[model samples]
Target: MKVYILWHVHHVAVDEVGNVAHFENGEFSARENLGDDVKLLGVYSTPDRVERRISVARTLPGFRDEPDCFWSAEVEVDEDDWASGYVTE
Candidate 1:
């Protein structure tokens, strides 16, 4: 079985001192033991951030984990004209 993992970073900043430029681009990886049944397809950030979402999937282990999954994908974003700040509502 094959699964897809989608991850994103919102706000792009953690604090007033932090900026979007400091945020890492993106990264993904997989973990599996030799002949291990349990498998994990993990997508994570190279540089940890305050806001991050990780989705996991179960699939057969592969020789290479860094496959290009974002090829020919379209993304849409909403623009409300807001500052990069912590919001709780």
Candidate 2:
């Protein structure tokens, strides 16, 4: 099974029509955001079936008090192009 690390980041965008959008950009990570260090644990698989979400865990460097920290991020990816880190466009 293939796994990855997805970091969360704050993002902002402005359009030519003066419309602005601000939201969490999951593909980015920064030291200021604690959750950026979280790791995507693995990709769940079922024979002849497709899954809707991926599992993640705060494996390393996360707060000790929250040792069992876990969550899921919605994404669609193939094993070939699983990115290890974020790439800015």
Candidate 3:
């Protein structure tokens, strides 16, 4: 099934948003991963739930600063995410 993954930067810069998304996408190797600096809000079953989470998150501290920093991507579960190996660099 398709699921929505939510992630937010922890006092990270705007330029790092894409990097975090890429990390979540499993595009970067373990050594180059930026997952540590990001806060995973939660995985949701639908985008609507993700949006609701964003709305609620925006009201919390720290999250208000990067209000739009919330990055979400739809992914399938129990599926072969990578048919082949990934490369970093």
Task: Give the top-scoring candidate (lDDT).
Answer: 3
Q: Compose the digit string of candidate 2's lDDT tens values, residues 1-89.
A: 43433332232244356443222364222333433344434444442121222222223344233433333344445544445777777
What would the C-alpha RMSD of candidate 3 be, to one decimal place? 6.2
The C-alpha TM-scores of every prediction are 0.19, 0.24, 0.66
lDDT of 1 by residue, 1-89 (tens): 22233432222233355533222345322212212122223433332221122212112133123223211112233433355777787
- Kindly report which residue pairs in candidate 2 clash with one another: none
Model 3 score (lDDT): 0.72
lDDT of 1 at 7: 30
What is the lDDT for 52 in model 2? 25
Tens-digit per-residue lDDT, 1-89, candidate 3: 99999987653322344443323354421221433357889999999999999999999999897676677889999878668989988
Winner on lDDT between 1 and 3 is 3
| Each prediction's number of clashing residue pairs | 0, 0, 0
lDDT of each: 0.28, 0.35, 0.72
**Ranking 2 against 3 by lDDT, winner:** 3
TM-score winner between candidates 1 and 2: 2
